[model samples]
Target chain A: MPMRTVRFLFFLLSIAAGIGLGLVYGWLIKTPDPGQLTPQVLRADFKADYVLMVAQVYQRDQNLAQAVQRLSRLDPASPARTVAQALLTARDLQYDPADLQVMSDLSRALQSLETPAATGEPAP
Target chain B: MNDNESRGNLYLFTGLILGLAVGLLISLVISPVEFVDIDPSAMGEAYRNEYRLLIAQAFQSDGNLQRARERLALLREADPARSLAMQAQQLVGEGASPADARALALLAAALTNPQGIAFTPQPSPTLPPGEEAQTTREVGQAIFTPTPPLPTRTPVPTFTPRPTATPMRALDAPFVLESRQDVCDGSLPAGRLVIEVFDRDGNPMAGVPVQVVWGQNQTSLFYTGLAPEISPGYADFQMEAGVVYTLRVGAVSDTLNDLSVPACGGGVRVVFREGR
Candidate 1:
């Protein structure tokens, strides 16, 4: 065989070998386990549900002080709370937290409001 | 083997090594792992499904298709509503469970018209002839205040269980005492306790009257969800460490021992659900 022929054959063999090994790696070497049935996921699910509960509370009373207090119990800016608030503002779809404009407005508002309190305590 | 043959074998080996490395990289990049942090996939299907459902609910409630799409894009579903109708129809196919069909129908409707879902306010359930007069009012208007205007009993029904197959009281309503911390946030310096209540169906119950009794007959009455609109279903209260609080709502109540918190100071949240 010519030199070029030998090189071509070698390349083909290499490609075949590589494909075989890659298959092994993709299937047998890799394992997937749900591992999702854990306390952490459970807690996250409950928190998500709780956010809905909070929204219902807002609908009932429109009491902002209690709203802030409860939201603070969870993370002040958590996605759960965000979902709740978004749901609470259902009167106008444009104002929903899911809306890009509303989300941007909210972010800007939060950033502007984010000055350290004069109380010398950490900012909430 | 001859010299030429040996060199050829070496070239084949080199090619093999190169191909293997490239192939390995390709395999891993295409591999779909369930958990991004654990399995190397950015996001798993589980989280995506949850995101989809949440966005669908939001769209159904708000009728904001644009907002729903924006939220969906965050999860890499740039064109979320494109197939929402198909997917919803599939879920709403014949023989689907009633709840699933209703949810999917809502999703489909929202996909068509975001602002179309109209929620009729549930009519206040009527009470017995004599008792009806006292209890007939807005669901949350009868909140009990903890501090000012204390201890004035009114004709408004406070926590009386209604007799009906379906309860007037929302199922999810209850006081959720969240926090494992011994100290309250600096925002409310004297505030150490937060009480959150949810109505039945797990919605936050607002303006429900409650009594927080700590110390000797030291009673303070208030309703949950008196917080700012940003923070709903929460009431703020201050409690001294080592003191115990007995929270009475309607007929049932629970006690919270501040001493239960470690001196190291993480907060404890004592959740009180209605009728619990």
Candidate 2:
């Protein structure tokens, strides 16, 4: 082959290799775990406003039972849980049949959550 | 390699490195990752202030003057808006009696928006002189003071006690007892019956059975209970002139058989009328 032609071929091959390497490096560096981007397991740190909006809608519709149920379904550890629980308590105060046992149960549930969890292994 | 080809290759390589460096520098400047530790104490203090304000508002709405005052006092101690706290304190100090103080405080608290507090309503402490004293005393004496009166015949014909008249009127029934005065966060006038039913936690109890009694006859009125379809909270009942009434509130349960009300526990008497 002519010397110029040979040099041209070599340059083309080098450019192709460089382009291929760049493509592979970009793919490897850019990939992210699918699980991390899922909607279900996303941390609910900033969901208070949405939760409160739903609760208020339930309340406005005078569906205290449904409001309470929806509120209870939320993760207890969520910051929104406090506001949800407060609204539920308010509903109970206004309308729930005054079952002392229910009140007692709620008190117990609040206390249990408020206390720190034990870390020691279970007894044999 | 020839000189011309070498120069072209060098330019391409230099351009690629310069472009890559520029891109990286732009990314670093525009969207740098940052780590910050939130000040929990400052956040907590802010939350506490908000909670205090909310409690004050609820109390004010319910005509609980004393409670409003107490909450505002706590808020003041916490160094929340100094001017607003001082204003609340001034209003509370003007209350004449303990009951007046409580009613005014609660009313003041209720006036604030619920969103402002972002907290649950705490149980209100029972106010002293809750309508009980007004019934037992002679019709005229009950209006003025707590003391029992000396039997004396005034020239003005003494108001005859009616044995058959219903003691309390229901909101939905024929005699719709509208709040004549803006009793919102204010004193409950003498001879007025304000019945508030509460559960064991002191939370307002809804839909309990309430009875108004006078002399020998008693009338039963179910508190328009709070259902999923209904508004939650107490069914407000007010008193009218010349008629004495007693309230009997039932327990918060389906079995209504467990009706336990303090006003009727020993039998309370309320005389309803406009002005003494």
Candidate 3:
């Protein structure tokens, strides 16, 4: 081919190669990596709040055993630990073996906590 | 170079430049971008308004005219917005003491502009009717000083029943048994028999299963299957005259350890002479 034609072809090929490199770079930058995102950690405050709420419900049901069990499961260093300890102390002061219903309800509640959450339900 | 070749080269270069420019413009236009929508001025005004409402509610709940007056005074200094200042001035005039009223007024005034407000003491305004007044006063006192003495009432004493102790006969074998009645009169008894088991160390073990067997002649009087109810740690068996009965308590723990007392095998061999 003549010199002018050869130079024109070289220039056209260079532009095409540049466009292809640009497209590849864009695709690589935009591609997402599933492993890069970490699963969300439960906030410490939320955990404490949940434990306190469950403890209050158990206390209302007069299930001291269950309340104590729930209290024991709470993070010992959490701010809610003081509340749990207070409740446990109060329960010890009033505990009576003759209160069979209270005892049974407490055992049942504590056992229920150990069971896995039902399908499509959030864990407490 | 030749005329045709030069023209072709010029055309190609122009096309590439135009394509590159267009692509760059399209990328810039389509790229995702985010912006904050809240107006800073409006946010500041909202904070001021919220603080005002909180202070007013607090004063109403506490019934502390003095604290209310002080808060209004502070509010007047901060905002001087004719409406807020006038409201604070009115609260102060309404029997609120100078010192407490002044403190509240100052807090409100300091919060008039967001810049001066350190932390909005978002007083909980939704307290129950019964607790509203007490809680408001508590909040006031908490801010001004330590909590004040709460009204005290003596608690009434409650009575609890004590468990009764009944003398039980010692079993020579592994167990001793007792029932509500040795013989039945066809009418069911009102109460149930409760059995308690204690380990050698005397601690109670829960969830022990017991098997009871009873019968008269060739037929069983009442099998464990037919009993109406049984207490925890105990088995109920219906009694019929002219029947021989036996009970067997079997536990896996007993079988695992040779010395572990079979939770079973407590015979209270009662040979009834007459129906009671």
lDDT of each: 0.43, 0.34, 0.33
B3-54: candidate 2 lDDT, tens digit per residue? 9878768755655555554444433343322211111111234343333433
Candidate numbers sorted by DockQ from highest down: 1, 3, 2
Q: Write the per-residue lDDT of candidate 1 for residues B26-63, one digit (tens) a residue.
A: 55555423221111012345444444554554333443
Each candidate's clash count? 48, 33, 24
Docking quality (DockQ) for each candidate: 0.12, 0.02, 0.03
Model 3 segments more than 4 A misplaced: A1-124, B1-173, B176-210, B213-235, B239-246, B249-276
Model 1 CA lDDT for position B47: 44
Chain A of model 1, TM-score against the native? 0.31
- Estimate how well candidate 3 is docked, as a DockQ score: 0.03
How many angstroms is the interface RMSD of candidate 1? 13.5
List where candidate 2 sits over 4 angstroms from the true fold: A1-124, B1-276
For residues B1-276, write the lDDT of model 3, one tens digit per residue: 599878866766765665555443333333312111111111233333433443443332222233333333432343333344344444444644333333343333333422222122323234355642221111111011112323322221111221222221122223322221222332333222223332233322122233334333222111111111121122233333333444333222221111111123222222111111
Instruction: Point to the candidate with the largest lDDT.
Output: 1
Query: Least accurate stretch of 10 residues (summed lDDT) in model 2 chain A?
Result: A38-47
State candidate 2's DockQ.
Answer: 0.02
